[model samples]
Target: MNQADIVIVGAGAAGLMAARELSKEGKKVLILEARGRIGGRIYPLPKEEWGYEAQGGAEFVHGEAPVSKALLKEAGATLTHPTEWWSVRDGPPSKIERLSPHDLQLEEALKKLTGDTTVAQFLDSNFPAGEHDDLRNFVQSWVEGYDAADIHKASALTLRDEMLDQGSWRQMCIREGYGLLLKYLQDACMQNGVEILLHKAVTAITVNQNGVSIQCSDGLIYQTKRVVVTVPLPVLQTLQFTPPLPKKTQAAAKIGFGGVIKIIIRFKTKWWTGPREQPFERLFFMLSKEPVPTWWTQHPEPHTTLTGWLPGPNAEHVKNHSDEEILTLALLSLSRIFNISIEQLREELATFKIVNWIKDPFARGAYSYSTPESKEAVQELHRPVDNKLYFAGEAICEEDANGTAEAALASGLRVAKEIRESF
Candidate 1:
């Protein structure tokens, strides 16, 4: 048994941020991570030569969050911003149908939910035949990858409110690996004197009037004045809390997080049919499609790679499918869109791989989302217990910027400040 001023469970963005902040203020902080790696979901796939190119966790830098950008810059991580001009692969490059007026209406209606209904309810009432309707399917697909969830289970109001109006920064990907960014954050924490312990899964948390006691799988107990939990929302659903979580927290956990399964495919050559100036970098949104509602390609980077995403229920289905099956689905989708032969794609693509987050025990799901019904759920999760056990993560974010690494960091820092003030 050991004691510290603060204990953080799950060394993801939130935990690391909290530890870094508290440690800098001279608080003894210990971060216990279940996985061998420090970054919870932020682990990089081996290179192209390895089995496949998959991102275990995050892929995008997502907007211009100063906290994330500053951390990356401080760590000397390479970042490249896109130019003003960007193209959307609307129709097949050859036959470009004007962006439809009908589609625009639907888009606007859905976007208005930023302050209104749960995504499920909105789609149910608005879509004539409901969310599964073919017409609404397109919108569902394009948006799924954003939250890594199906539209039916998402929250429209949460999405819209958190939607970064910072126009130009909407679409961007990390030039390197998103995992690299996590590594940088971890390094920053270490430099600030935070101690990170890997493979130490926090199995139990017992809190009393005085403080909190955390128990790991290895039978080690850690005592601390305060505990900050940053595990994914879904993971919390399965955890056994002492004295049982309050009725509200239990219900909030039942809300459950949406699932996202992303497939990253690498090609040997640039086999895009679109013009060089028009190289396919758009979301490649299949507006009304179901299952794999959306897919897209990032220009020829280190390797000509096309990353496809399946969010929500479809993402769950993809996770159940084998790697070869996922690869087949991706190739079939690409062939149909670009009018390319399967043989052509096969020849151009050297290898393809899938990253199944659903199978990942640490991150049962990608990120947390606040459904119209679950809006208050997140706030409930953030409520501290006896000022000893606090929470921070995408699920507990108290802002429109919910379910993002930046939000996670922001939430963690806020909790750290609260603890500092109390001390």
Candidate 2:
């Protein structure tokens, strides 16, 4: 039997941020985390452990997010700019040597739309197929591949809003892995007096006039005054809320999320960059019409690793396949893209790994996306119940920053202020 002024449900970015903010204000905070490790969706893999390749459960800081920038600066993490390369599926694998007029067309299109609608709807309404197939492919691929979203259901308005807010944003990689920031946050929490219990799966949360009662799988009953739930929307749907949050539940159902299957392969040699024999030595990425549509190298790090990403509809097509089968398919896709034999790729392959978010119980999907019907879903999720139950996650972030690390951190900070004001 343990208690605190607040019991945070997850040790994710949002939870850690919330715990730090509240605890700094002299509130006793207890965080229950289902996983043994911290950092939730922001899973960071050590460069040494990952065959010297920089990887994260959710790294890829697409834009210069203020929260991430400040934290990374404080943590002494290095962010490197990645060189852009493009390729399209033609007879012998056509390479897009330079950026085209269609590069930032999505941003341009976003300015034209007046009302909230699905990306697919917006694209269809404005740029019909046949004449706009090139633009269609470019935008659809960017939205679905980058976001892991279903364009048909994903909110065009949210994408536009986020784009509008993005000023001179360039994609970069964190040299020291994303987990370092999490470690800094975790250390901050400890300094501020936050109690964290790892491997404590919260099964039920019952809130009454007295306070909030939390039941953990470890047979511990925690009684707290308030609870800030920072778990993924999918995982939150699994928890048993005593007085079921009808509005939150309804919002969760309406909000759209996408699935991703990221496979990282390591070769004995820097095959793609070295040896004039290889066709794509100068390029850092290869975008193809294969099963794994996106393949990128570990550049500026002197590693021979490539990450294959299967996003959006492509990931869904084979989401149920076994790990071994997925690995085989990745090889096949690469074999076709680089015009190499599968046997050769398998022979050169030193390691094959994947992070499957679709099957993860803690995170049923990769992240949230705005849908045609998700006009107020994020806002509904943000609304606290009785000022005792607070919700915060990337999904519930402001439209301009939703489904991002910045959003998660921002939500945590926002909710902590809300809790403080309520008290």
Highest lDDT: which candidate? 2
The clash numbers for all candidates, in the given order, read: 7, 2
lDDT of each: 0.68, 0.81
**Ten-residue segment with the worst summed lDDT in candidate 2?**
94-103
TM-score for all models, in order of appearance: 0.84, 0.92
**TM-score for candidate 2, residues paired by index:** 0.92
Mark the regions of model 1 whose C-alpha exceeds 4 Å error after superposition.
47-54, 81-91, 94-104, 107-115, 124-127, 130-135, 159-169, 254-256, 273-293, 300-302
Q: Model 2, range 95-169, lDDT digits (tens) per residue?
A: 564433354666677887888888888888878989889878777887777778988888887667655654423
Q: Which 10 successive residues of model 1 have the least lDDT summed?
A: 92-101
- Model 1: per-residue Cα lDDT over 109-193, one tens digit each: 6565546665656766766664446556554553465666556667676544434254412645566666667776777677877
